[model samples]
Target: MKLTPLDAPGYEKVVYAEDAESGLKSIIAVHSTKLGPAAGGCRMFNYPDLETAKIDALRLSKGMTYKNAAASLPLGGGKSVIMADPNTDKSPELMQAFGRFVESFGGMYTTAEDVGISVEDIEEAAKFTSHAAGLNKGAFASGDPSPVTARGVFLSCLAALKHAFGRDQIEGKTVALQGLGHVGMYFAEHLHAAGAQLLVSDIDAHAVAEARQRFSARSVAPDDIYDVEADIFAPCAMGAILNADTIKRLKVKLVCGAANNQLADDAAGDALMERGIVYAPDYVVNGGGIISVSTEILKITDEKWVDRKIEQLAETTDKILTKAKALNASPHKVADQFVEEVLAN
Candidate 1:
């Protein structure tokens, strides 16, 4: 594999690891350690190129930093990405080797499941290292965090509705969803239960069919989601979909979802602001997964704290939106300031 020089200035540590024995090749990026030990998820994907995977790792790790800080969790940001398709490359040997690599960080970076990784996969990885989360056994096991993450995004969606449309509800509103993955599917349930009509799209036709059948959702082509006339545009897919071209096609008033690094760059967020769309920062809305994993790390079995933290996402959304309104600035800018303020002190 060709190696690219790490050029991320804001990151605390960037490491590339390879294990020929298990056929493992990965990159781990720790973006910050000011608040506490670095913690994030490990993603596996068949990236087209190594540089794309590296950029994804760097962007995701940085997003996790802001995510943990905004959620007020005493943990920093880190992420690892394995450049292989889980469909073909998943194996005990490969997982254990990755776990050992995580252990090399000596608890400075703890990893959980993300993307192609699963609860069982992380539990397998845990056999080689205590720095793994999302396990299925033990008192701290949290399992898959997709439902909780969707719940948080749901809460943030309502908050965005309240801020943008002056209603503290989703009833009768149309929400266009850009993905039908775990988070997106569950989020669709929340919106459906809240009486919000759904327009859903996904690369997987089966997932789209399931959602459409379950929620009476209207199915649209994956690319046509952006053109759907709706109250909110929820992008639950991968990051950077909200770049210059897509933003120009948006027909919604509120933009919120469970996808991390939703903005192609900071300017994409500013573009939404300039278009008069109420944009919920992706990191703020998608912090539920981290919040759930934190419960395992902190050994807190209390359900109340989890509920409170999820509910606080709405409060945080209101605060950021209000500040943006007051300053007449982009909500993303305001959110960055909020994260910086929390991390600074």
Candidate 2:
């Protein structure tokens, strides 16, 4: 395993690891440790090449650092990415090998579920190391973190709504969701229960069908979702959908979603700002999953504690919006400032 510390300012450290037996190659990027121990999820993906995986890991880890600090969690930012096809490459032995790789870090990084990973998979990884979360255990169970993450996104949606429409209630509003996966479904359920109209889409037809029946969502084609007429656009799928082209087609006034690394590039946030769209930083609103899992790791297993932290996300969102408005800067810039302040101290 070769570990490299990126010379990038604001990012404290970065490391890459690989295991041959499981055909697993991973990059563990630790962006900061000023707040607390590094906390992030382990994402598994089938990258076209190692360079792409490294870039993904580095970008995600930096996002995690900003995310934890913005969410006011006593944790730093770090992430691990396994370069393998989740569809056919996952196995008990492979997961065990990954866990051992995690253990090699000596507790410097704690991991939970992310894309292409499940709670059960996390459990499999736990057998090789105790740093894994989402396992059923004594006095606490680290089950799925999506619901908690969705709650944070929901609250952030409200914050964005209040900023854009001057209303806190979604009762008569419409939200166009771009994914119906775990976090998206949870977000849709909450929004539907609150009497909000939901327009959802996903690459997986079955997931979309389930959401349509369960939440009474109006389904749209995945590619056409951005053009849907709605009060808010919630992108719960992959990142970079907020790039110049998609942003030009969006009919929503506000954008908030659970996906990490939403911006295609740093300049995309400015593009949203220029379009008069109230955009919430993806990292800020998506920290609930990591926060929930980290609380369990610290033995603060109370649901109320998790709820409180999630609720604080709304406050942070409000602050970012306010700062952005006052300074006439993009919310992403305002959020970056907040994270820089935390890391600097």
Candidate 3:
């Protein structure tokens, strides 16, 4: 494949790797390394085409840059995406090949887990590259970031509720939660314990069923999740669900969740604002996972430090929403501006 100019000109590196024998095709994007080596997760998907995969890689890597900066990590931003279904296409040979592909970066980009990739998969990658994180090898090795990420999202949602409803209470509120992944399940538990009603959906039937049993969550068809009438719409699934079409269908007052690149484009965020919907920027609200994994990478034993930072996510969310409301602008734009200011200094 020939090189095409990434619309994101600020990216430092973009790599495409293929091993036909192993059926491995992947893209790695390092958006920045100003603070330190770029670090993010490796995600697997069944993208329809290489261009689509490249676009997702570029967008997500850029989000990582902002996410790391906002989370105050000394690391920069990077991401990798394998263009194959993790369930059916993953293999030991493919994992090892992807590991070697990551090793080729020579520590410039370190990785953990993301959607469709797990800790076991990272262990396989770690065999070929020390750059892989979230391993169970040492005392400080972070195992899974989903719980921490869920906590951060929960905090941010409370912040959003405070901004939107003049109170920070979760009791008696109805939440339409899309996606029942690890983070989403934990988030539902948080809300359910707080007396919030949950309307849940996921591509994984087992996950959806589990959420229903665990939290008494009402199940909705995955595609129909957007139409649920609730106090908040939490998108824990993939990106771009808050576009023009879905924005019009939303019956919620606030939008908050763990999904990166939630807005299809900047305009989608603006559209949310025009419609009087409060949105918590995905990167800001979902920094806990990276914060959790970063502790392992930095070899820090201070759980207090991690807790303190995660707690501050509420304040961060409040600050962004307040500023956006004051300016009649999208929180997404406010978040980008905030990240730019952080990156600038």
Candidate 4:
């Protein structure tokens, strides 16, 4: 195992763990444990290079810390990235190897599913340690947090829309969706039912086709979808889409979606604010999935219990937007102040 500290500020502990027998190689970035035990998801990706992987781990872990703190969860922030192709690199042996790597951390960090990782992968990783979520089977089955995550984002978007436009309903509003994966599809269903006009796009043709047929969604090319005239731009696919180029081309009044780390850099949030876009903090809106998994892990089985937590996401989002307006600051800055206050306590 080789460990290197990321040059990025605020990341104090970063390590890469490698296992030869299981063909598992991973980077564990523990950004901060000041709030509580660091917790984040384990994501597997075919990173183009080690440096990219390290940067991703560092950034994601730091985001997790802020996410948990902002949500008032009793957990710090950390993340793990497996350097492998999710399509061909997933195997029981590989998973077990990754589990062993997770075990090396003791109880310092807990992991669940992120991009390219499934609930089954979490189950597999559980074989080596108990620091895993989405493994309960009593009432609400564990693992696969996308539905809850999508629910949170949808609700938060609604709250942001209400605060920004002085309306609680999305009726007749147009929403341009940029991903048709699990979370994206679920979100589209919610928005469609709310009478929002849906325009969809995805790298996967089948997903786009399915969304188009089911919702009568107008299909746009992935790159061109950002330029579509819509009331809101929902990016459910990958991160960094809210950078200078995409933001410059954005034709929406609000940017709220399920994508993690949507802003390529912190400055992008300011840019969105400057453009008069209401930007809901991604981590705050997308925390429903983790909150659900956390409840399941703690053996809270009532369906309403999870629903209540998920619904509160909207309230939190509303508060952030309201406070931002009151302070005449960007929503991101407002959220940061909220998180800083939480962490301080």
Candidate 5:
């Protein structure tokens, strides 16, 4: 295994890892350490190129800085990416190799599960280094964060619903959800149990079929999700789904989901506000995973602490929406301002 360092202007540290034997190639970016050591997740995908992967690492790491602040976790922000087809390239040796690279950062960087990565895969990574979190087994393990993350997002959606429509109940509400991955699937289950009507879409046909069979969801094509006329639009998939085009096509009154970096650019938030759509900041709404992972980073064994923090995340979401409405500003701007104040303090 070989690790090559790279210069990233806004990041604390960036490295590219390569292990020929294990077929592992990954980039790890540490965005900040203002509050504490950097902690985030490792994402594995078949990115078109290394440049795109690096960009994702940088953006996601910075998003983590905000997410940790929103969750009130005593940690900074960092993220990593493995450039390969997660469905095909994943192997125990490759996971362990990635773990070795994470270990190289000492305590400055801690990893957990993210897109295309699972608790079982993280367990494999944990075998090589102690940096991996979200372990299903162990004294301090927080286990898989999917359910908790889904819970946070569902609560966030409720908060947005209250702010938009004067009601917080999901019962009888129609939600169009994009993506049915780990977090997405759990989110679907939450909405389903709450008696919400679902319109779902995903690149994976099997997952979409499962959601339809299990949740009684109506399936839409991936691109058509934006056009679905629903009360809420939940994007639990990849980032930047709400750019200029899709935001205009959206027919929902509230936008909330677990996807990170939902806005393609800062102006996207303003556009959503102009449309009268209550946009919950992605970093604020999708923070349960980090809150759970922080326990392993801080070695906190209390499960109740995690629950309390998740509840607080919902409160923060509500506050942000309230402040945004009062100021007649985008929630994205208010959310960033809050984090900026925390980091500045």
Candidate 6:
């Protein structure tokens, strides 16, 4: 195993790790510890290059910081990303090596599941260190956070509807949702239960087919999702999907989902505001997962506490939306301000 520390302004620490025997190459970024020890997910992806991976770690870590703050959890923000593809390069050895790297953080960072990462992999990592959360087995184990995250985003959609459309329910509304991963699928269940029509798309045809069968969702080509006219556009896929080009093509009145760093840049948020689309900050809207995982990290075994926090998170979203409307600013900007206020005191 080899570790190389890197410089990252505004971040507490950044390091790249590689294991020759297991072919495990990854980067971990700790963006802040002002609130408490950092915690986030470990994701595996076949990034184009090391630079791309570093940027992702940095952005994702910072996003986690805001996410924790938004959820009012004591944990700070941090994240790790693996360079190898989950389908082809994943192995128990590689996951164990990654666990060793996480152990080197000395409890300053705790981890859970993320894209291309499974509960089994985190369980394997748990064999190496106690810094992993979201485990499937254990007295305080908080399983996969997808359902909680989806629930938060679903609540956020209702909040945005009340703020923007003057209604609190989604019944009979059309939701154009991108990506049908675990979180997306769970969110679709909430929408289906609420009687919201789903217009869904995903790179995974099988997942799309499942949503179609389950919710009678209309399947749209992945690229054409932006053109679907709907009341809400939920991006439960990769980051930066709401960039300049796609933002212009969006016909939805509200945008919310479980994807982190949904905005390509601050300009994208500004653009969405200009276009009259109510933009819910991804970190704030999708924070229910961390709220659940934090319990295991903090050893808080109260499920009712988590339920209360999830409900309060919706209230926070309502306040941010209301504040943004009063200020005529983007909700992301308002959310950043709220996080800064949290960090300041």
Clashing pairs in 2: 134-142
Show how many residue pairs clash in every candidate, following the order shown.
Answer: 0, 1, 0, 1, 0, 0
Pairs of colliding residues, candidate 6: none
Residue-level lDDT for 93 in candidate 4:
81
lDDT of 5 by residue, 177-206 (tens): 999999999999999999999999999999
Per residue, candidate 3 scores C-alpha lDDT tens digits across 1-345 of 222334457799998888878888999999999989999998999999989999999988999999998888899999999999988999888888889888988889999899999888888888888788888776778888899999999988998998878999999999999988878988999999999999999999999889889898899899899898899999998998888999999998899999999999889999998888999999999999999989877889876988998988878999999998898888999999998998899
TM-score of 6: 0.99
lDDT score at residue 203, model 2, on the 0-100 scale = 85
lDDT pick, better of 3 and 6? 6
Per-candidate TM-score against the hidden true structure: 0.96, 0.94, 0.96, 0.93, 0.99, 0.99
Stretch of 10 with least lDDT, candidate 3: 1-10
- Global lDDT for candidate 4? 0.84
Better of 1 and 4 by lDDT: 1
1-345 per-residue lDDT for model 2 (tens digits): 344444555566666666666676777777777788888898998889877887888888888888888877788888889888888999988788778878877888888888888888888888999788766664567579999999999988888788898888899899999888788889998899999998999988999889889888899999999888999999998777888899999998899999999999989999999999999888888888987787667788566888888889988999899889999999998999898888787
lDDT by residue (tens digit), candidate 6, 65-130: 999998999989999999998889999999999999999999988988999998899999898989
- Stretches off by above 4 angstroms in model 3 are 1-8
Residues 277-316 of candidate 4: C-alpha lDDT, one tens digit per residue: 9999998998887787777545676768778877888898
Question: Which lDDT value does model 1 have at 83?
Answer: 85
lDDT of each: 0.90, 0.85, 0.90, 0.84, 0.93, 0.92
Error of 6 at 174 (Å): 0.6
